[model samples]
Target chain A: AQSVAQPEDQVNVAEGNPLTVKCTYSVSGNPYLFWYVQYPNRGLQFLLKYITGDNLVKGSYGFEAEFNKSQTSFHLKKPSALVSDSALYFCAVRAQPYTGGFKTIFGAGTRLFVKA
Target chain B: DVKVTQSSRYLVKRTGEKVFLECVQDMDHENMFWYRQDPGLGLRLIYFSYDVKMKEKGDIPEGYSVSREKKERFSLILESASTNQTSMYLCASSLRLALLSYNEQFFGPGTRLTVL
Candidate 1:
């Protein structure tokens, strides 16, 4: 079974400070990981994905994630946090389909609170 | 740009009522998925359709059914809406031919259902 774990229920950071939202995964073969962000009353927006190649993948809104093969982790990072950046973050891993296509398993989510 | 749209942003229903949540994607995606989001629980897949008339149970398919009569639309059915089933429902679609590594899902704005 492919699964993702987000250890933090909530993370607090100050504006302009670096922020990290941790994520780890367990999968059968190589993992395909993704990061999504959800704002108040809005649907989730794709942040970035780690499929192949570059360990460091840049994504939208000045966000980036580093894929650590040995650690089985893909942590979302930002060099400088903004109050607007505070939102619910989700980590997901794609699972191979049994009979048809692919399925994605998502983590419980991490709520980020950036203080101004 | 890919656009996924849900039929409603908010809905209220009584217990035991039959409820339908509809999703449509403008992109010609071969795979469509339905997931429920709860606070702290993130997103749990309820059902997925790989092609028209083809549907598969996801992680939490109990108490719910789905329909995919056309390639562009997928509908989730709740036979008897229960309080426990009250949550945000999200619909997503992805290209089937894309490699597993690059099969990124585009999500709808989501429907928040309240069963009282």
Candidate 2:
């Protein structure tokens, strides 16, 4: 079974400081990972995905994630955090439709709070 | 730009009431998904449709059913609305073609359902 784990329930960071939201996955063979962000009263927005590409993938809103094959981790990062950047972050693993079906398993989520 | 729209932003229902949550996508996507979002649990897939009338059960499909009569629209049905089922419902769509580079799912604004 493909699954994702986000260890942090909440993360606090100051504005202009680097921020990291941790994610790890367990899957057979290669894994397809994704990052999503949700704001207050809004649906989730896709940040980035790692299908089969460069380990370092850049996403929207000055966000990026590094896919570590050895560590089985895909962590979302930002060079500088902003107050507006505070939101709920989710990590997901895409399941190949052949084995089971086209299902994506998401992590429990990490609430990021950026202080101004 | 792909756009996914949900029927409502907020809803209030009573116990044992039948509830319908509708989702529509402007893009001609082959795969449509329904997920419920809770505070800590990021998103749990309730059901997914690969094509018209072809629905698949997701991680948490209990107490809920889905309909995909047309390619562009997918409807989630709650047979008997329960307090536990009260959560934010999100609709998303994506192209099924694995060969396509852009397989990211586009999401709707989400509908917050309160069952009392």
Candidate 3:
């Protein structure tokens, strides 16, 4: 079964410091990984996706993620954290099995708290 | 830019009432999804539609149903609303590809439904 795990329930980072949100996946075949952000009382917005391309994927709001094939990890990163960047982050995965069915899975989520 | 819109931002209903949540997307996406968001649980997929009149059960399909009679619109139905069903419902749409699809979903603002 394809599944995603966001080990951290919450992360606190200081402003101007680099931030990293961890994500790991388990899938039989190649994985299609994605990062999404959701603010308080708002819907989720797509951040970036890794589908068989360069490992480094840049997304909106100057965020980027690195897809580590061996480690089966796609971690979301930002050069510098901002107070406004504090939000809930989610990692998702989609894969096709040998039998030919598409399965998508989402992590429990990581709440990022950027401290000023 | 792709835009997904939900019919209501907030709703309150009594227990056992039949509830309907409507969603519309303007981008002409071939795929639409319904999810419920809760604290710590992240987003749980309830149902998805690959095309008009074609629906697939997601991870959490019990206690809810979906309708996609039109391409642009998708509706979620709760036969009898209960307190456990109170949640933030999200609607998302993405383009369906011929091959193994790996597309980022665009989400609506979301509807916060409260069941009493």
Q: In model 3, where do residues sit more than 4 Å from their true spots?
A: A97-101
Error of 3 at A96 (Å): 1.9
For model 3, residues A32-85, the per-residue Cα lDDT tens digits are: 999999998888999999988799999999999999998999999999999999
Question: Per-residue CA lDDT of candidate 1, range B1-116, in tens?
Answer: 99999999999999999999999999899999999999888899999998999999988999999999999999999999999998999999988885353577899999999999
Which runs of model 2 end up more than 4 angstroms from their true locations?
Answer: A98-100, B99-102
TM-score of each: 0.97, 0.96, 0.96
What is the fraction of true interface contacts found in candidate 2?
0.60
For model 1, the stretches where C-alpha displacement exceeds 4 angstroms are B98-101
lDDT of 2 by residue, A1-116 (tens): 67899999999999999999999999877788999998988888999999886999999999999999999999999999999999999999876663334778899999999999
* Model 2, residue pairs in steric clash: none
State in Å the error of residue B58, model 1: 0.2
List model 1 lDDT by residue over A26-61, tens digit each: 999888899999898888888899888999999999
The TM-score that candidate 1 achieves is: 0.97
Model 2 per-residue lDDT tens digits across residues B1-116:
89999999999999999999999999899999999998787899999888899988888999999999999999999999999999999999998876332377889999999999
Model 1: pairs clashing at backbone N, Cα or C within 3 Å: none
